[model samples]
Target: MDADAAPRRVRADAERSTARILEAAEAVLAEDPTAPLERIADAAGLARATVHRRFSSRAALLDALAAQLAQRYVQGLAEARVDTAPPVDAMLRMTETAFALKLAHRFAVQLTASMTPEVQGGLDRLFARLREAGAITAPDPTWGRRVYLALLHEVNDLPADSPMLDGDDLAARAGLLVGTVLRALGGVWPPAR
Candidate 1:
């Protein structure tokens, strides 16, 4: 074997283990915010000592989860093409992306309670674009962003099997959310504002 192969394999193993722990933590914490680290370990199928070795404390693990959530949000926004898409189209895309991320990371969404600076900056730019395009007519456009985020939170709290969140229902949900936000911001309903 190459001299570097052993270390590379070990690093890959560590990364996988850490990812498993974070996924398990999100699931366990979403079900019960006060679940213990041992419970998280059980969910991850990892030994308590392994979890402890990976994250020195619960706070550290939570911090890692929050970081992962922020990274995913950034990536989702990019994939949604928020910067280049038409304002209204971008809003719909962003809503769909946020909805999925919020559902996947319920505990992190609740824990953060606010957008990370990067996410906030991206949304602020998008809202500005919306206003420039007349898709938002609110004199104070900040309310638009707030309302958009509030709608995502509401949707995120829905039961996993809700009809609104069924596999093919995502587009309809996104359209409803974007349309409501536009109207709430004084834009016309049929997206012609």
Candidate 2:
């Protein structure tokens, strides 16, 4: 093997290990926010010393996890294609995507409440479109935005006594949350059935 190739391989391995640690951290923390670093290391198949070497401390780990979640949230917004979808559809899509991630990484999402400007702008555009399409009827734009944020928070704020939802249960709850928000905005619910 070439000498340069050896360093490249080591770096690649390190990146993989770091990704594993972050993924494990999210999963373990999802189940228990106060899980120990040793447990996180074990979940990642790494030694506790290795986890410490990588993160230094629990606070640093949380910081890294928060940053990771924020970045993932931004990426999920892009993937949801809010810019092109009709405003109402986009809102539902984005809400579902956000709720899924927020559910999977509840602690990390709690730690970081800031959104990137691009996401904020996209959301603003969606709100305007919703108003224009007569899907929402708030007198002030800010009120509409506030209502949307509140609904999003409500959906993400799962009850402490709630058990982990399966795929079907999660989809049902997300649909209910979306439907409720739409109803609040004067959109019809139950589709006139």
Best-fitting candidate, scored by TM-score: 1
lDDT of each candidate versus the true structure? 0.82, 0.73
RMSD of 1: 2.7
Q: lDDT per residue, candidate 2, 57-162, as tens digits?
A: 9998888887787777678667766667766667777777877877677667767444555556666777777777777676455566667777777756666444
Clashing residue pairs in candidate 2 are none
**In candidate 1, what are the lDDT values of residues 1-193, reduced to their tens digit?**
8999999999999999999999999999999999999999999999999999999999999889988988888887888787899988888888888778777887898767236888887887788888988887886556677788888767656665677654446676787678778888878767753
- lDDT (0-100) at residue 91 of candidate 2? 70
* Model 1 vs. true fold: TM: 0.89
